[model samples]
Target chain A: MATTAVAAPSARVKAKQSKRFKIWIGFLFLLLIAGGYFIVERLVQGLPVTNLSSITPWGAWIAFYIFFVGLSAGSFLLSTLIYVFGMMEYERIGRMALFTAIVCMIVALTFVLMDLGRPERMLNAIIYWNVTSPLAWEVHFYLVYIALLTTELYIAMREDLVRLAGTASLKGKVAKWLTFKNSTITESTKKRDHKWMKILGTIGIPLAILGVHGGTGTIFAVVQARPSWNTGLFPVIFVVSAMVSGTALLLAMYIIKKKATKQKIDHGMVVSLAKMMVGFLFIDLGLQFYEYLVGVYGLEHHHLEGLGTMMGSAYSWSFWGVQMFLGAAIPIFLVFNKKTGTNVNALLTAAILIVIGIIGVRFNIVVPAQIVPLFEGLPAGDYFPTFNEWMVSVGIAAMGLLIYTFGEQLLPIEEIQSSEKTEG
Target chain B: MLSNMLGSKNMTEKDWNNLLDTALPDVEKEMDASPFDTKLSFNMADDARKVINENLNIKDFHKKYHSKLLKEFGEEVGQDFASGADEPAQETDGVKWGMVIDLRKCVGCDTCTVSCKAENRTPPGISYNVVLEQEIGDFPNVAKVNLPRPCMQCEKPSCVQVCPTRATYKLKNGIVTIDNDRCIGCRYCIVACPYGARSFDFGESYEDEMPGYNDVTSPEYGIERGERKPGKTPIGTVRKCNFCLHRLERGEEPACVETCVGDARFFGDLNDPNSTVSKLSKSPRAFRLKSDLGNGPNVIYLK
Candidate 1:
């Protein structure tokens, strides 16, 4: 396996690279057309163009927002395992994890901007800081976190960028511009980058867990009006599930990207990553179980109604079908079963299932809590995302995928095979 | 000017002091000419020390000096102090705003709804208040309850808590206000409100039904925000009942409370125990909607 480092990125990498470029371009064109339609509709009719109403104030946009945030937090946490904790076995995915984190954050913020009633006044959230509001705190945390992630990412790639700066390709040009003229790869510079990466990763661990995603969860959980969301454990579940989704997404992306480029898969690392993903999933499931159990045991009418709306109502398919079956059952089976557990294809399927299932989890979190009437006499909300809302969400997600695809094509995200051996 | 008067006063220590001081000899002439005994006057002066300098209650001071002051200053001055000190029993003033609604007085005709819309000139889908009609019990025995829902304007408003921009907050006067200029219109406040009191102004209007519906924006919070237009302040913002703050500024009651033909709405300061709302709030029949939520809503209802 150590000798395999000498092979380099062979003919397989080159062939797959050209095809992925074409796929990326086609996807981008489709996203542009879809985006153009929704943009015009949104401009003309405002928010009424979607199914959103005064009752269901948050919908697909919010779900997508949390989804992307989970991805970002998950990927960043994985990157932390390598940089901060010095987990050498998982080091191959470190920079790639950072890159994915950055892309996911971009996508998440875009969803929020699209969802705003006054997108033009989005800056007002920053201009007027409301210390009491969790959303306000989230806005500030996001800005600071983004800057840290970018700086850390730049440092992580500095050596590679310096090396690539001399090449002839467009990526080489980007590297040249990014590195500046006086760039040098020295032992001291490596030490400096390594030290900074540790510091940033250390800071980011808490910021991501407590500030970014947990605060995002708090934005909902703090609302006493929504009984389902008003729990101390809610934000904890949010962070844990974020780890679940993040690990699944990164693992899925790593394998899919390698396979598409015909690069050799790191079998041991994938198995370990899969194990970590399932472990996080089990923990997330335990938290969710307790959350549901407590809600059921309380038997408070509103809590019961909310739980019923999630588990047994017309919309329960999202629970049983997507959230439970696809998100948990199928992925758990694929990972644990003796026959399919080791196969790369089966693990990939499990990874994709987990990603889709998490979307179900996010939807269930938001919609079920809201569908139950807040008061006895008030009408229960009946909501489904309108076509425009679904299309807009799809378009945005496709746009994110396109960017990630193109980014992988240009960046040196794939690791230079490490030569160090543990021969006894 | 008073040196001649001091000369007439009998003094032991005073006499020695007066001899060294620059004063006329007849300073106490009127006091010496008094028919009352000098020893009596000296004894009375000593007692006046206890009354004036010591810890004497003013009532006791009046009781002790009543006869003496009356004999000396006559009836008019003493009587003047008595009435002046206790003029009028304390009465609080100013507009302590309040409202009274009789559930027995209400027919649930929805007149308040029409009046509120007309007064506020609200755009389409934005109702400040509404009467929710629900039937209770079975078939022949069913009874209809016409519950009119308005902004609770809770002392602990959920809308205020979840507002990301501090766009919405509660005023000391018991009114909840939203600064449309500051509202990012995330509608999180709307969702968080248990009362279902909030509405998002999706920039819709009755332009097809009415010619000038979009031609004017309501002057909320006393600011004449001018014409309703796309991307305007209130157009893409959250709105709800403010007890008609603009109308309240004009010394008028809220249009819903005023125009309820059934007269079932009550409004006023819950702070003043003597206020109509305060008195009504204490009634055994008076209870808040969802009192268990701990929102401490200002609005109270009579069953």
Candidate 2:
């Protein structure tokens, strides 16, 4: 009777855990089905089904596309800080950063595909190779950046994969398949993997800054017609904001995963990461302030109109409420306030809010400029994403989360040993 | 009898000839008074009579006397004569098509807008051209300005510069054309156009209100896009004015030019210095929209 009582509790606990997991899977599956139906309908009916018109050709999908691109670039840059710059303190989330970057890139590209009126002709952008186009350049850069990220991630994981290869679990099987049959866990192989990671990470710095994220910013910056976007400082702001979002995402993911798995949270690392994220945010704000100040002072009609739309229009709440308040102010406070700075939960909230805030920032960047008519006498565009748009976005985001979860389960994403044990 | 015959509705051929012979001066005497050859003039007169009777064409007569007429007149006049005679084979080399809109003449009737829509067969929300009407200054001292806007066909078109696919391009004739089959409907061009000239085809049709609206598509850029079905090449692509190239191919003016009530719009090859647009473009009152931006718009507006 005593043994039955002891075993029954454990069985109940297992059932509870599985039920939680099943519910999560069910939620994602439901999102996918709902989103999939709309996506198919969009393809069948074309862009007419959306609220988008000639006046507002780009809407929610484009906003989400750039948003995910920012996230991917941000996270990849964070990983580079760890591997290339020998920022060993932030090494715990290095692999997670790389993995998050890849997942975000997938989601971003999916958003772009959905935005395209003729999604079938997407490959034509590559096949026809318009060298003058910043967008074409971005497409090529994305592909190369993704390849580089995958390689860097693999090298980072070699030691862990080699260690896990001997087990009889799913991760073990994946690790065995990924590594060569004759791969060994020797001191020399470890040194070699670390050396390769450093080299790739060093190469990745320019690729991420000048090619990936900075290039994404250049796509908007090179638009000479939109005077607000036509500036040299825009790309620099993109890189800085990417650093902020990337750090916050990794911090949130790390803390949340630890809590979920009932593992020990690294409070010191979490605090330090939150500080770094705020530091980047401050720089981004400074640059943006100057950008807006110069644009306003220029007294250019179109530039003023664009800024007015972003700051004073109906959607200004996204800029003032979400971007400034939740994304910037609260997160900065959470990181700086003596009471909340050290609290893991508070820091986690700050990190999540910052991530969401960056999304608002991206929307502010893409939507406002488009809403301002290119000509003065023309009617201004009014756009809010439709129900179908929100649903598809949720589906795409859920897909990215599901990918991240599966990747973590099948890969050695978590820290295998305590910091002290590793040091020892 | 002469007054009666002159007033009569019916007159015999010999009687009409006799009346013309009596009324007209002697042709041989007039020809001999000036110019080179009497026989050439006599032959021309004979050919003119045949031409009047529909037995010989005027073009054939010109061809028969081309060299003789060139010789009778020297280099400058000779060149002018030859060009006037060979008007059908007008030289299109170095042609830069341009438009000159006389704003003072425009009545803001939206005739160009309606005609452009009919000619282009553009779908809902896709206007290839528009006329912006606004009253400037305060209420006490207000003046309404009507600006008919078309594709500027800029020398450095921002749309062409930003297009991820090079589906939109400028022809040597200064008309900017979109290869709808190649366009992926990204609408980047629409966003990049400074003049708000480009539009995206969101697949909306006039079929809801106008039956058989999609039966035939406009032959834009001289390509006969047959039907206006959903998911068709242009139905899901970016679109803009191509100066009615199909009409230009048949030696007809753009629909906007043909149908303008005030005759405010003029279209011609600007490369020809003697062309009407080229002359108007050089006028002191002529200016381009946002000229300081240096896009070098082919569409000129006369203030």
Candidate 3:
């Protein structure tokens, strides 16, 4: 893939490319600085800087935490389609998915750290280990899942690393340091790598579904105090929506990267991935329909109040405008409509919208349930992320993107060869 | 004529005694007609007179008759009678402290709320107790209900169940205490508390309004956290009412109970069936908030 995209360019074109890259990095670095300033302020000032109250103990940080966790789990599950299930068509994005999952997990954990009032005492969650608490369980699972992701990414890159190790470029230098001196790509070595990838992918599938994302959902579901989150189906919705966001994110990244690098856009993969993303969105919408339908029909006071807050209250724009219309409906239409579905740019837009929609879904999930007063006669919670919270979040997200860009620059993330293209 | 005779400065002691004996009901005759225990009744009557006269202390009076009453009425009734006069026993062993608030008597004064703040020295945005006031019904028929809520000290505390660090836990005495030192400040416990009784100490202070506001911290759970500061144990951790364990340790009622303007709140050992809280909790009017959730709240409310 690099050879095909790298056909000798003129010096002017190379300079333009390098200048554009510098500008992009510069832009991201400035965001990092701005965000970093707020993060430090938040750290010094504590959670007081955020709009969080005892009534709404969790706000944007937790919302973003779950959002990124979903993204990570979604991307890892997508990679499983190639490594575990032998979906050759998606193999081009396979390594990208794994790397994205790792990056998203880092971002997710960072959000959690920001949310903690005593960030220094975070280790107590591990040291004490309350098995009953779903949050505690999630903490353990996240660590284990991250380790598994790192290991799997290494194995997936073993062949690529060996190939790049022979070159003198920066990627080759990093590859030389990563690979063992005796590392070779024989037929058996290839078979062994493939086997390990399958084994790890199989293990990761359950881990992601049951332990990581599902466990993240369990953190909320077991909160019987919140009627909106106490259902068994909540975790399932989490995993499904993760798939939607994960696929959308990868589709967006793939298209955006291809355009940026001036490489041939894998139009077929782009269309197929968009369809897969929308399919997950439809399932997510259906599950959410029943989730709300059952909650409404139950007529339980807190549950109904929670639903009312999400659907009709001041925050309903997030539900109707962002989550439903832009996130789900538009994306579904774009993927299914023949003309737009085939248009690469249109599909890209749908993918980006879906990713943004999932953010709305996550915020809706976390905030509304808390905004409903735990008991009648108590003050109803009012919360919106403060400027500090938004800035800190932007900083953290930019930091994740920066890490991804650096990783792409240094590692053999891009495929060396284009495999057989499956028709979309 | 009797007043004139008594006013005579030289009224002799024997004459005064004779006058008292004649004026009062015949004690011997009364005791003889009452029951078979005339001797014991006569002794009690004499002691009662001495008590009224302030010649003997009440503790001695009860102590003197304790054995006789036990012999006469058997152990159970005897114990009840003895305890009625004796000071309440300071038996903390196996004690489950509980509260029963009479909502009708609350008056919506917010005194409990204020006194709790002063007593606990909780920072801004952190109130261990609050009165939830609402008007029920509509228009002319409306009735205001004042629900003074403190930590329920739930038997099955959802906060305890969800605390990943076991920092929040139910003590043997039924009060749920948070170990701020061990807490990760995750706020999961706050989310899990059904009563909305928990607060994350966001390190906000009234220092602007009252200088030296952070000079001394409330000794919550008997842990003497000296001063409030950023990143302190409680400053960044979750906190809730421990039923004022420090007060309980010193044999005082919770601040809310002591300062309630309406005299609505009763706090005592729920394990002691004879305690005021236990009796109040057994009343037909007594109920707990969100009892359907089955947390077995130690805080009972009288409607």
True-structure lDDT of candidate 2: 0.86
Cα deviation in Å at residue A79, candidate 3?
0.2
Model 2, B1-303: lDDT tens digits are 778767876788987888899999987887788766889878888899998888996667767777777888767665654434546565647788889999999999998889999998888887777989888999899999998898888888888887888888888788888888888888888777878898888888899899999998888888887888878787788889888889988999988888989999999989887899999999999999988777789999999
Arrange candidates, best DockQ first. Answer: 3, 2, 1
Estimate, for each residue in B126-178, the C-alpha lDDT of model 3 and write its tens digit.
Answer: 88999998999989899999999999999898998999999988889988998
Local distance difference test scores for all models: 0.83, 0.86, 0.91
Model 2 lDDT, residue B275, Cα = 97
DockQ (C-alpha) of model 1? 0.46
Residue-level error in angstroms, candidate 1, position B174:
1.8
Best by DockQ: 3
User: Which has the higher DockQ value, candidate number 1 or candidate number 3?
Assistant: 3
Residue-by-residue lDDT tens digits, candidate 2, A1-424: 1122232236666587678777877888888888888888888988866888778788888888888888888898888888988899888889999999999999999999998878889988898878999888899999998999899898888888887888899989999999875689888888998899989988888998999889989988987778888899998988888888888888999998766644457678888888889999999999999999999999988899999999998989999999999999999998899999999999999999999999899889888998987776788888888888888898899889889888988998765555224223
A1-424, model 1: which lDDT tens digit per residue?
6555535556666677887768768878788679768966876678988777787888888998998998899899999999999998998889889888888888899888878888888888888777788988998998888898889888988888888889898878888988996799999999999999999999999999999999889988998888899999999998999999999998998898767655667899898898899999999999999999998899888888988999999999999999999999999999999988998999999999999999999999989888887777777788898888887887778778877777765776655434122110
Q: Report the Cα lDDT for residue A418, model 2.
A: 50
Scored against the native two-chain complex, candidate 3 gets a DockQ of 0.60
Best by lDDT: 3
How big is the positional error of residue A334 in model 3, measured in Å on the Cα after superposition? 1.1
- C-alpha DockQ of every model: 0.46, 0.49, 0.60
TM-score of B chain for each model? Answer: 0.68, 0.69, 0.70
Q: For residue A180, what is the lDDT in candidate 2?
A: 77
